[model samples]
Target: MKLHFLGTCAGTEPMLDRKHASVAVECDKKLYWFDAGEGCSYTGHNMGLDLLDVKNIIISHTHMDHIGGLGNLLWNIRKLTQMRSELPHFDGVDVFIPNEDSKDGLLKLLSHTEENFCCDYENRFYGVQDGVLLDDGKVKVTAYHNTHLVRWETDKPLSYSYRIEAEGKSVVYSGDVGLYTDLDPVIGDGCDALLIETGHFGIDIAYDYIKDKNVKRVFFTHNGREIINDREGSLAKVARLFEGRGTICEDTLTVEL
Candidate 1:
């Protein structure tokens, strides 16, 4: 399986090297997008990724930084399909979003476009709840709720972390978690990779929290002060704590496991 990092910056003002928080997992010629941060699709496609092969889009939450480019992504998909004069090879796209309001907003935003704005291809949207999202033949996706927001306590507990198991390896994506322990259920005993978000927390804090955990590789995303302001120090801290087990991700970086 291949993991592609499209954007690695947090929701800060524009940075030179990074965009936002987006990643893709490619397996068996299919692309599964995780988080649609600003300019994600553009970066992904320009990096030689076949965006037309996208089958599933898994969103962690509705934060602007996370879904800022969602509408543009859908528009691009449709634009490419029209350009080719063929329906999407998959014929359908399944997107799992945590908030229905955000999804509805995206739908409305797309509806106002040109050409009567009807998508020739099929796009199915699913409101994600806390549980197993999918177990495709090649990959397994499970969602665990966290405490990022407190708007609607009655409906959803709020944010989420994800555990993706594929090709004999497992990866945990910390999607703007409220706390590190919020992933206890999903992280469980161990994972091969941990695509953690450093937006709300520091590198040392994250390293200390997962030091003894069973993760083999730690890739930092959605960066914050530690990474942007004092990168050398953060890299030193990770090197000392993880001893090469940790990696600071950048836009367009790809890794295979």
Candidate 2:
């Protein structure tokens, strides 16, 4: 399996070498996108990734920084299919979103685009709820609601974190949380890798949270001013604190696991 980092910056003013938060996990030649941050599709395509192979797109929340490129992503997929004269690997694509209003708004916007944004392939949207979101025999994904966003209603959750298990390896994605404890449900006993966000928290806080959690590796994304302003210093701190188990991810970085 391969992990591709398309965007790593937090929801802040534009940065030099980063966008928002986005990543893709490729297993068995199929792509599963984690977030559709700005320029994610463009970055992935330029990095030689096959966008047509994307079978599922899972959004952590409806925040603009997280779903900014969603419409453009779908548009690019259709454009590429027409340009290549080839059908997508899958007959349809599945989009898991936490908010129905965001999905409806995006679809409404696409309705006025070129060709009415119509295509031969189907693009279906599903509301993300806690529990197992996907299980294809090869990869299993479980969603856990987080406190990043508040929901007055008890039934619907507004944000989530994910646990991905595949090929005997477990990976956890901490999609923006109000507190580190918000991921206890998904982290369970432990995981091989944890893709954590440092936008609302500090690196030390994250390190302390998972110090004895049995995590093998930690990849930091959705960075904030602390890391962005002093990258070298932050990296040095991570090296000393994590002892080679943590990394500050950059755009277009691909890791084989």
Candidate 3:
């Protein structure tokens, strides 16, 4: 499986050479999108990725940085299908979002675009809840609620972290968390790779939290001020702390596992 980093910046003021948070896991020629941050689709396409191959899009939360590019991503897919005169890889795409209201709002806004935002393929939306979100034989994805956002309603969780298991490897995507411990439930035994966010915490905090865990690799995304201001210094520090097991991810970086 290949992990693609589309956007790696945090939800802070805009920065050069980065957007927000977005990643794609490619397995068996199919793409599983984690978050649709700004310029996600554009970056993926420009990186030579096939947007039509995206079968599922899972959002950890409805934060602007996480879902900023959602509408544009969908539009780009539809535009590609039209231009190529070919159907999408799947009959429909499954979009798992924690907030249905946000999804509705995005769809409503898209309805005003060209062709009424209509396409040949269906873009099905699903409300994300705890437990297994997808099991497509090739990959299994499970969701665990996090406290990044408070839940005013009792029906479902408002924020989440994901555990993706594919080809005997388990990976965790910590969207944004109120605390590092918020991921204990999903971390479970351990994960092969942890794609964590550093937007809310510092690198020292992250390292201290996962040092005892069984995670094999750590890729830091959603960078905060510390890493943004002094990337080289932060990377040097991470290299010393993690002994090469950690990475300060940048946009368009692809890693195979």
Highest lDDT scorer: 3
lDDT of 2: 0.91
Candidate 3, poorest ten consecutive residues by summed lDDT: 83-92
Give lDDT: candidate 3, residue 146: 88
- lDDT scores in order: 0.87, 0.91, 0.93
For model 2, where is the 10-residue window of minimal lDDT? 84-93
lDDT of 1 at 242: 85
Q: Could you arrange the candidates by lDDT from highest to lowest?
A: 3, 2, 1
Per-residue alpha-carbon lDDT of model 2 for 1-257, expressed as tens digits? Answer: 88999999999887778999999999999999999998999999999998888889999998978999889889888888888765545466899999877888999899899978888889999998889999989989999999998677764679999999998899999889989999887889899889999999999999889898988999999998889989999999999989999999999999988
- How high is the lDDT of residue 228 in model 2? 94
lDDT of 3 by residue, 110-176 (tens): 9999978977779999988889999999999999988888667664568999999999999999999
What shift in Å separates residue 84 of candidate 3 from its native position after superposition?
1.1
Better of 1 and 3 by lDDT: 3
Q: After superposition, how far is residue 241 of candidate 1 from its true place, in Å?
A: 1.5
All predictions: root-mean-square deviation over Cα? 1.4, 1.3, 1.3
- Model 2 ranges off by over 4 Å: 88-90, 153-155
Candidate 3 TM-score versus the reference: 0.97
